[model samples]
Target chain A: MNSLKQMLPEVAPPSREALLEGRGRLVAEARDEAASAGRSRLLKRRINPWTALTAGLVAGTLGVGAALAVQIGGDHRPPERVRLVSAAEVLSRASAVAGADGAARHGRYFHYRWQEISLPDEKSRHVLGSGESWVPAGGNGRGLQRMQPCTEGNAPDCDVVLNYKDGATDREGFTGPRSPKYLRDLATDPDALLARIRRTAKGDGTADDRAWREITDLITESVGTEPKLRAALFAAAAKIPGVVADMNTKDAIGRPGIAISRPGRSPQQIIFDRGYRLIGDRTLAVGKGGPEPGTVLSAYVLVNEDVVDRLPAPRPGLVR
Target chain B: MTLPPALEVRDDANELDMISHVNEQVATDDEIVTWSLRDPEVFATLYDRHAPAIHRYIARRLGPDLADDLMAETFLLAFRQRARYDTARTDARPWLYGIATNLIGRHRRAEGRFWRAIARSGTDAATESLAERAADRVSAQMSLPALTAALARLSKSQRDVLLLTAEAGLSPVEIADALGVPKGTVHSRLGRARRKMREALGGIDPLDPREDAIDE
Candidate 1:
């Protein structure tokens, strides 16, 4: 068996330059941790309210700038022209696109990948993270979720395994009893779906707010799966009171898109590309006891997705 | 034993440097991991000591290009999971190898492609120099495809156990600790892997296969 070690060609250890480059990542993490610690100290004490507000603005500006840099560096495509349109118009466009997309959704597994940036609170470091999942389409079966904390310089395929099991749908953000199959079974009529979403949507805020949240959740989940369901979800969202569309908006990843949002302190906005494709979503920190107004508290951009015939290995007997 | 004035000064500086180096060297990996919880910066010491070996191991498994990214990822992941690391085990090599192995598992397709490419072409991205490839191919031409084909045939678990033993040079017990599998599972997997390799190599024992094809 000793010969097996030598079966492969001799490989040089990483060059000094490569080693340093890799080490730089660890060093940056350390630096971020230290900054997070400092932020924690700042949050714990009572300071002059005006000074606190000023510090928040400065920190928020710097954090948003760094995030924007990451987005710009990763995506080089010219910005799409964003036109301020009525909420009804944006939803209509999205509905038409979804209806016209005749691609059949018939695969054993649905794989979703997205990049997320979140500033959990005032103290914690704003983290850029990404996640991916491979789930069985219809029923309870084996699934895998991979997540990783990413840096501006490097965002590789996730290494952190968040879940691997029969009911990974719950972890994939399809709240209680909501799986891909469940979404597929939902009403396709816009009004009927809106009624069902209002009933199913739970948690804080008014009925419209909760329903809006549910609509976005379904939109994110069913984007690559059920086109008819997606069309209904968008059209349903359009009916929510105070829903508005910002013509000029860019996702956390700096992809220009039309942002459809409802007025709220922490408003969740979904950004769509020119073709009305769901590109990304973000929650803004507006008004008061958080980061400065217009700061994105959390955001995620869809990286890629596919209907894989079979998930990658980890299947015991299914090797090549 | 008299030294020149410049040499004496350099010797004095080296002696002073050794004192600080010795202080750092005294802290075990466990201690550093614990210290890093508070300081965070101390985690770099672990990266400095172990990353080269980890990087090379990955390079062997999945060519050099991917190895760089995965190697960096392994340490970052280790740092993130350091709090959960069982410090009872003083040596972090098994733990680090375990992380590296998991990352390699994700790239199973790329690895399969790498092996299949070699089986078909007798060379891959890792086959560095033309002269080395030419010389190695002469002796290995008959067995190269067989070896690679055999590797591609092994189940992911069997391959992980086998490579942890052969590539990272971990004992079965350490392999168990690294993989979170029982020692019995490791032995059986290793046995099965060796048996597959033997059958592929014209009934020659993989436990003691001929060295004709091996360069190192």
Candidate 2:
């Protein structure tokens, strides 16, 4: 049984002549796009507003988990920026505070409460979802997760709870949302931690984006309990290429914070409070297709985190 | 402080090094795309980086004769549509492959003919390259006809997913991104396509899991 990749006949790469010709065509296209800047603006004006909005909404739905979004319109304007802080400075400050902020506390479970916004393509309405989870701190006991999706007028009927009887253990090399055992096993040195993240991260996008996503996932799930790990994670994130910080952004819940963003169309921005605590993260739609350049396609805010002895039952009136 | 010729050459080398270092500040694909907004010539960097692979992909599908123009067309279309590129994707391979695949879609009959020609005659434009793989060539010789017939029979979408996996070496996720389809669709289509290929090849499995994992 031959692999398709092997069975397929091998073809030569483009010849030098072909390469030059293709490059020439690309250059020509680029010049034309630049030359027609005015025409593009007029074309943009001619685009139906309703059609553009529909495209954006459709893109938003696809953008939810896949991180792939649409860009519409022709305005090639980059987003405005005032670089008040560098990403290194922000991460350094966060790392400094992380290790000293709180004393070590013992508890049976680590509890986290967060709110996430998702856009289901068909409905095209923002679905606000909340989740609460309690993982056994020792990594060998029952774990509970309660999730609910709510909208403006409809709520209270969709609460769902999941239980992991043998503790919530992440896959051995998984980088996203890990358990205490996984966090403890991670390298504390910044360079090594980043290498490990690169090795294990399974997300889409560039390598740097995947590394940053893994660090953010750790911050969201386990870092609140392990201050030392949180510091290391922040340090690791500071090393990702093309990371920049803006001191004027706000999280999903309107809390002002500094944002560290990767370079991309709808780049994910991680928000940190002035005191250097991770508050939330959001994806900004900066390119043409979907929403306006500054629209937040999806976002998550950490409301509370603590070490609890017992997993509290779902909030009164919220879950049956 | 006049020095020997060797020292002067070293000084000149240092000056050149400094200039090249300044020029070599690498930029991500997204950054290049953004910069191309102001200086369109910057778009040529993307072509230099990806044109060979894109050209080869087109050649394998539609034969080397049309690869020259289609590859240029692919980049031209991408350049025109640069504004719509989801900047969120830092690596432009999927997006470029998508554009190339769309362009390839237009020459569907040409591609079918390409496969049929291979099925009819075991030799292909790539046979010269395949000559090195003597062992694989034996099996490929036996399977090429059946494989081409299977590929010709598959639906456009299924073949797209399968070839993106087999030829472009794109992961399932990347295929989804390139085609603007769901990841699940890539998975299902690839499964069906491979199963058909296996049946066509008398259950030899054109793609053996042990060789390479498709889900990756």
Query: TM-score of every model?
Result: 0.43, 0.43
lDDT per residue for candidate 1 within A1-320, as digits (tens), equals 36665555666656555676787898799779867987885775556476646765776777775554453234333213211135676787677567655545444676788877775654443547666667665434555655564232244433322232333343433333455556656746888888888897898888888998888877876654656777878888888876766544555665655677764422677878644678878777656776555555777788766677876654332211
| Quality class of the docking in candidate 1, CAPRI style | incorrect
Provide i-RMS per model in Å.
23.5, 17.5
Can you write out model 2's per-residue Cα lDDT over A1-320, one digit (the tens) per residue? 23766666677656556666777777677767667886786787788577667766876777652332312323343223322235776787677557644434445676778888653332353647786767655445455556664332266443333343233433232123455556666746888889988998886777777887777777666533567777888888888876776544556565656677664522566778755678777766656677554455677887777777786665666542
Taking chain B only, the TM-score of every model is 0.80, 0.82
Query: Residue A109 of model 1: what lDDT?
Result: 70
lDDT at A71, model 2: 28
Per-residue lDDT tens digits for candidate 2, residues B1-216, read 111111101111210010101111245677666656655666765775677788888888888879989999988888888878878887898999999999989999988888888777765674446424433544634466666778888888998988888778889999999999999999999899989887887775655656443223
| Candidate 1, chain A: TM-score against the reference | 0.59
Best by DockQ: 2
Local error of candidate 1 at residue A215 (angstroms): 71
Residue pair clashes in candidate 1: A1-B207
Docking class of 2: incorrect
Q: Relative to the unseen true structure, what is the C-alpha lDDT of residue A184 in candidate 2, on a scale of 0 to 100?
A: 62
